[model samples]
Target: MKLHFKIEAEKATSDIDVTIDNLVVAGWAGRDHAAIEHHIEELAALGVPRPSAVPLFYRVSESLALQGQRIQVVGAETSGEVETFVFSAGGILYVSLASDHTDRKLETTGVALSKQICAKPIAATAWPFAEVADHWDSLIIRAYIVEGGSKVLYQEGPLSSLRTPQELISGYTDGAAKLPDGTGMICGTVGAIGGIRPSSNFTLELHDPILNRSIHHSYAIEVLPEVA
Candidate 1:
């Protein structure tokens, strides 16, 4: 089956189609000298081990819902903000925003399974990586959560906080073929503002001041009843 994603093309007035075959998420990708130790400590408190490498790749399904789509989750107490990198088969790389919508409760049990629980939501548009490569470190990622009626800043930080896209792609390849065409990777996210918590709605964006453009996407979370 084919997977489709929306994109605001450079020439098109409306969104266009961006197809892919695989989706991956890089984890424990913090670039700080203490990044590994920091994540280890963070997850250890919750009973998880720190990965051996700074950037570990988790391959997710390509089948994903687009922006504005309502995704259902069971026991998903929170959604982490993230930026998704899209690899076009023709060799064009683009950047978009996404929420690695996860089930926090299940996270305590299994990180991969917890990640597989919800339908990932991604932006309807994307920005060419070539245009932002020079100032890539300046790109910013910001996410907001709708609790009750107001939107609260859930996470916000610059791309510099995490390993560069090239570094991540290299690590993920690990002496293998370069990330093939039709591959989409969700770059790791920054720390949460007030700790992880549930939200009825989630919104995220990737801002590039150098190019004066941003990629944005939002979705509503409909928590399904848990049945054993």
Candidate 2:
């Protein structure tokens, strides 16, 4: 999958088209073990099974990466969680935002299958990893969902809550300092504010307090009727 993104750096802003050959979603990646277990319990309440291991990596199709304003799903039991997206291209790493939109109902059957069935929406803009390497933990990720015709905060937390990009890349690549070129990974997410639930629209944001800038993206969900 080819994605066009604007690279925002301290010295320059350039447009780069990245070709992603591999896409992986990292789950249960919280820095704190207790927090990770809390998230597992949160999902368990909804019938989702606990993962066999901590920080599990689920390989997904690169074609599922999307940069559109809308998406379609099979039912109303799907929801979105904001996550930090890291991409490697031309030997350079970039940080961005992505929503791990998932099917809750199908999630009970299989987490990987539920993820594969939904489109992963990502922001079209990215920041160079080197630019924010010093204060990576301060960066915040948040999401808002349209609830009862009003936009409400769904999830919010600092990147520190989850594992760092370097940590995740190393974990994924078996101690490699960086991911292979033409690869992307969606890091783990924070817990939902009011619990996970389906909504017609979902918005994601990655805020850099030190830089005073944010990358924002929103996508509307269209639920298609199920015929069985």
TM-score of 1: 0.88
RMSD of each: 2.5, 0.7
lDDT, residue 68, candidate 2:
96
Q: Candidate 1 on 37-132: residue-level lDDT in tens? A: 665676666665556566778777777534556888776575655665656545667667778877777777878777777777877677666677
For all predicted structures, in order, the TM-scores are 0.88, 0.99
Task: List lDDT for all candidates, in order.
Answer: 0.73, 0.94
Model 2, residue 21: distance off in Å is: 1.0
How well is each residue in 129-215 modelled by candidate 2, as lDDT tens digits?
Answer: 998989999999999998778999999999999999999999999999988988899999999997889999999999999999999
- Candidate 1 — worst ten consecutive residues by lDDT sum? 1-10
On lDDT, the leading prediction is: 2
- Give RMSD (Å) of candidate 1 vs. truth: 2.5
